[model samples]
Target: MVTTAAQIGWAESAALIFRPRVGELLTNTVLLVAITVPLCAVIGVGGAWLVERTSLAGAGAWGAVLAMPLAIPAFVNSYAWVSAVPSLAGLGSGVLLATLSYFPLVYLPVRAALARLDPALEQAAASLGRGPVRVFFGTVLPQLRLALLGGALLVGLHLLSEYGAFALIRFDTFTTAIMDQYRSTFNGSAGSMLSGVLMLLCFALLLLESRARGRARYARIGSGTAAPPRRIRLRGWQLPAQVGLLALGIAALGVPAVVIGGWLAYGGGTVWMAPDLVPTLLQTLGLALGGGLVTVIAAFPLSWLAVRHPGPFSRLLERTNYITSSMPGIVLALALVTVSLFFVPALYQTTALLLLAYALLFLPRALVPLQAGIAQAPQSLEEAAQALGRRPLRAFFGVTLRLVAPATAAALAMVFLAVAGELTATLLLSPIGVQTLATRFWSLSSEIDFAGAAPYATLLILLSAPMTYLLFRQSTVLSRADASAGPAPATSAPTTAETA
Candidate 1:
C-alpha cells in the first residue's frame, strides 16, 4: 500500500481526478455496479427462496444448476456471448455477463442462510394473517441482512477488480484502464493514480459493508432443535416456478455451453487435436493443485490462531492477509515483482514465485472454511482423544481433522478452481514459457482466434465442473451444520481479482 501510494504525486492525483477519461471510467464502473449488484441480489435471494423454501420439484437438482455458473469464468462467458453476437459488446453486455456469472456468489451464501433460518419466525408471522410476501419481508429478510450485505460486498469488490469480462465486452473500468495504462506505459504514474482511486473505492466498500453488517446477532436462542422448515406449497404457481428455474439454469449455463459446442463443431477437425492442448491442460492442473495445497497449508496456522486463540493481534493478522486479496491481481503482481527484484532476485519469474502469488491472493478462500471448521469442531472431542493417550497432533487428526474434513476439502477445491481460472496474476507471474489454460485462451482470443481458443475454454470448464460440484455439495454440509448449530459468525466470501 505504501509503495502504491508513493507512486502517485499530488499533481498526478489531481490530473486523474480532473481528467474526462477518468470521469468516464468512474461513471461506467458505478453504472455497472449499480446495475449488476441488485440484479444479483434479487435473482440470488429469489432463487434461494424458490429452491430452499418452496415446494419446487427437483429442488436439489435446481440448486446444483443454479450454483453451476461459478464454474464458468466470467471471461469465458463474455467470449461465448461476444462470439455469438458481436453487437453485444459494451456496458449492457458487460453487466449481463457479470451478473450471470457472479450471482452465484450471492446465491450460495443466501441459500445457506435460508437453509439455516429458524422457520418458526416466519410461521408466527403467517399465523398473524400475513401473506407470503409480507411474511418474507417482515420476518425473513431481516435475518438475511448479514448474508445479503456480505454477498453484495463480494460482488462489488469483484466488479472493482474484474478485467476479463469487461475487457471482452469492450467496456472499460478502473481495472481495464489500469491494465491498459501499464501495457502502454510500463509502471506509469497514471496507472498508479488509477489504482489509488480503485483502492479508495475498495476501502469505501469495505467500510460500508462493515457498517451495514452491524452487531446484530441472527442466531436462534432457546431452540428445542428446530424442525425442518415446512416447504411452502406453490399450488397454482408450481409450473411457472419450475419454468422460471429452468430458464435461469439455461440462461446462466446454456449460452456458454452452446457457444463452446458450436466452436468445437466448426473448428475441431484442426484445432481439437492440437498437441499443445494436452500440455496446457496438464500445466493448468499442476499449478492449480500445487497452488491449492500450498495456500491451504499456509492458511492453516493463521486460521487456527484466529479460531482457537482469538485476540486483537490474530485478528489483525487475518485482516492484513485479506487486504491483498481485495487488491487487483496486477497490483499484487507488481508488488511481488518489486519485492523479488530487490531482495530475492533468484526467485523472480520462477514457478515458486508464481505459486506464492497464488497463495497470497487466495489465502482467504482457504482460511474462511478452515476457520469455520475449527470453530465448529468441539474442543471436548480433541480433549477426549488426548485423554486416550494420543499426542496433540494425533488427537487433532483423529478428532478435529476428521470433523472438518468436508470444509477442508471444500477449501482445497475452491482454491484449486480459483487458481485454474485466474488470469491477470498468472499473466504477470508465470514463468517465461509457461502457458496455463487462462493465458492461452486470452492469447488466442486477443488474436481473434475464437475457434482456436474454444478448446482451451472447453477444457477449463470441464476441469472446473467437478470442483464446482464439490463446492455445492460441501455447501449443503455447511448449511446443515449452520442450521443445527445456529448461525455461524460471518466470514468474508471469496472475491475475484483481475483487471481488464
Candidate 2:
C-alpha cells in the first residue's frame, strides 16, 4: 500500500485524502464498525451465555443455530435481505447484515470459551456470598476476556474490510470506495491512497486489541482436572431467553434460507442447469482447498515459533501477520498485482499468484488456532519422543503434530471457508476466465439476476456449512479436553503416545 501510494506526488496524495468523498467514506466505515461490532459482541456474548452457561431449552440445538449465520457469508446475507426488501440499502442495512453475519464470529468462540470454563471458579464465587449476576460479572466475564477481545477484533476488521455486503446495499466504506477508485483513477493512485488510510485503521484495531489483551495469561497453571461448568437455571427467564434466541435465529439464518429457496423455486430446473454452475463450483472448491492447504502450511511454522520460541521478535512477527491479514483484500490484491506485473511477469494472473494472495490474506485465520493448539501440546511429549531416539523434526511431526490435529483441521476449515466466500481479492487476482462462486454470485447479483445468483449463493453457503460445524465442534471438543484433562503424571511413567 505504501509503495503504491509512493507512485503519486505528495500533492496528488493530499488531494485524494483531503477530498469530501474520503470523509464520507471514513465516517461510514467508522459508524459501521461502531454500530455493528458492539451489536455483534452483545449478541455473540449474550447468546453464547444463554446457550452454554444457562439452562436454555435445547441448548445443544441452540448452539448450532447461533453458529448458523457463519454458514452464510455477509454478502449472501445482504443479497437475501435486498431480495426480501428492495428498499434495504444504506448504513442501517449494512449494520443489520454485518451484525447478523459476524455475530457468529463472536458467538462461536465465546460459546466455546463458556463451554470450557471451570465450574469451580463460579462455585467458589457463589460460596463467597456473591449473587449469581455478581458471580458472573466478576468471575466468568473476566475469564472470558481473551475470547471476547479476539472475537471483537475479528468483527471490527471484518466490518472494515468487507466489500460486497456494503456494495450490495449501496453503502460506501473504505473498501468499496477503494474498489471504485481503483477502477477509475489513473494508476490507482486514489485507490492506493484510500488503502493507506484503511491500513492505518487496521493498525489501530491491531494496537487496540493488543492493549486490551494486556500481558495477562488466562491459562490454568496447576495439574488438576477442571470440573465441568454447571448450567445456571434460567427459571423465569427461560421463555424470554427462548424468544430472544428464536428472533436472532430467524433474523440471521432464516432470511437467507427463505430468500434463496424462493429464488430457486422461481428459477426452477433451468437455473440449476446453467452451464457455468458445475465449473464454477469445481473451481471454487479447488481454490478453497488449495488455498486452505497453503495457508495452513504457511501458518504452521509461525505458530510453532510463537509457541515454542517465545520472544519479542516472535511476537512482532505474529503481529505482522495479523496486520497483513487485516488489510482490505483489495489492498493485498493490488499489491500482488503490482509486484507480479513488475517483478515476476510470468506469475501475473496465475493460480499460484492467487493462492499466494489467499495465504497472505488469511494467514491469521490459520495462525490463531494453530498457535492455540500448539501451545496446548506439551513440549515434554516431543522431548520424550526425542529421548526415544527420534529426531527433533520427527518428534514434532510424530508427537506434537498429532496432538494438535484437531486444531490443524479447524484452522484448515477456517481458511477454506474464508477462501470459498472471498470476493474482492478473488475478483482481482483470479486468472482470466476463472470465476469462483463468490465472483459469479457478485456478477449475477450486480446485474439484478437474483435467480441466477441464487445457485451460486446457495453453493457458497453449503460449502461453508460443514466447515462452520467443524469449527464449532472442534473448538468445543478441544477446549473441554484442555479443561478436563489433568496434566501428565509427574513420574517416570511414559505418556500414552510414548506407550503406544
Candidate 3:
C-alpha cells in the first residue's frame, strides 16, 4: 500500500480528487451501502423474528429458505434480474440485488442470537403492560444491537468491495473502477489510489462498527433451565406473514432458481454440452476443493490459538487475518501480481498463486467456524485422552477433531462455495488459458451472451446448493448448542469472501 501510494504522482492524484466519474463512483458506492445495508438489516431481522419467535406455520422451513440466497452469488442474482428486465442495470438494481443476496448475513447471526436469548426479561416486560412492539424495542432490540451491528458491518464492507454484482448491474464502485483500470490500462498508480481509498473506507467501517458494538456483555448469568421464549401467535396476520416470507424467498432464491432452470431447459441443445463446460466445471471444482482444504488447514492453527490460548497476541493474530481477508479481491490480486512479478516471476499466472489468493481472501470463512468449534470442545476431554497415554496430537485428533468435525466440514463447504463463485481474483490470478465457471460466466455475460453464460451459471448454483444447505444447517446446530450451554457472548461477525 505504501509503495503504491508513493507511485501516485501529484497530478494523477489531483485528477482523481477532481474527477466527476470518481465522485460518481464514490456517491454510488455510498448510496448503495446506505440504502442496502439498512434494508437488509430490516428484512433479515424481521424475517428472523417471524421465523424464530412467532407461531408462524413452517417456521423452521422458512428459516432454511431465507438462508438459501447465500448460496446464490450476488452476480448471478444480477444476471437473473437483468435477463428478465433489460433496464434493470443501474444503482437501483444494484441495491435491490445486493440487499436480496446479502440479507441472509444479518438473518443467520440474528436468528442464532435470538435462539439463545433468555425469555425472562421479555416476559417481565410483557407483565408490566408493555405491548409486543414496546417489549421488543425496549428489551429484545437492545440485546440484538451487537448482532445487528456486526451483520450490518459485514453488509457495508461487502457493498464497498463488491464488483461482480455491481459490475453486471453497471453500477460502479471502487472495486469495479479498479478492475476497469487494470483491464483497460493496467494503470497501477490509479488503481492503487482507488484501492487505497477503498482501504480507508473499510477502516472507517471497522472503526464505526467497533464503536457501535461497544463493550457490553450480552450473556446471561446464573442460568437454570432457561425456557424458550413464548411464540406470539400470528393470528390474523399469519396468512399475510407467510405470504410476505414466501415473496421474499421468491425474490431472493426463487428467481435465481427459476432463471437458471429456464436457461438450462431452453439452452439445453447447444449450451448444456458446450465442450468447455465440463472442463470449466472440473477446473472450478479442483480450485475450490484445493483452496478450501488449504485455507482450512491454514486457519486451524490461528483458530486453535485464538480459542485455546486467548490473549492479546492471539486476538491480534486473528484480527490481522480477518482484516487481510476483508481487503477487496482486486486489491489483493493486484498486490499478489506485483509481488509475484517482482520477487517471484516463476510464480506469476500460476495455479499456486491463484490458490494463494483464495486462501488469503477466504481464510476467515474457515476460521470463524473452526474457532467456534474449538471453543466448544471441552479442555477436560483432551486432558482425559492425554492421561489415557495419548499424545497431544492424538488427543486432539481423537477428542477435539471429532467434536468439531461437523463445523470443520461446514467451514470447508463454505470456503469451497465461495471460491467456486469468486471472480475478480480468478480473473487476475488464474493461470493463463484456464477457465473456471465464474470467469467463463463473466466472459459470456460481459458480451451480453446470457445464453452462453447460462450453463455455467446454472452449474455454479447447482454446485453451491448443497454447501449452502450445510452452512445453514451448521448455523442452526451452533445456535442450538449455544442455547443449550447458556447465553453466548455477542456473536462475532463472520467475514465474507467476496468483500473486496
Best by TM-score: 3
Instruction: Report the Cα lDDT for candidate 3.
Output: 0.85
Each candidate: RMSD to true structure? 3.9, 5.3, 3.1
Worst 10 residues of 2 by lDDT: 491-500
The regions of model 2 sitting more than 4 angstroms off are 185-187, 217-225, 300-315, 368-413, 486-500
Q: What tens-digit string does per-residue lDDT give for candidate 2 at 349-418?
A: 8999999999999998898789889999999999999999999999988999999999999899889889
Clash count list over all predictions: 2, 0, 3
| Residue-by-residue lDDT tens digits, candidate 3, 1-500 | 56755567677676765688778878888888889999999999998899888999999889899999987888899989888777887788888999999999899878878887888888999999999999989999888877788889888888887788888877789899999999999877787778878888888888787777776666665663457789998899999998999899889988877877787677768887788988888899999999999999999998999889899998888888889877789889988987897789999999999999999999988987898799899999999999999999999898989999988997898899899999999999999889899999999988988888998887888888887787688778977887777764444433332111
Q: List where candidate 3 sits over 4 angstroms from the true fold.
A: 9-11, 373-408, 488-500
Q: Predictions ranked by lDDT, top down?
A: 2, 3, 1
Structure candidate 3, residue pairs in collision: 327-500, 328-500, 329-500
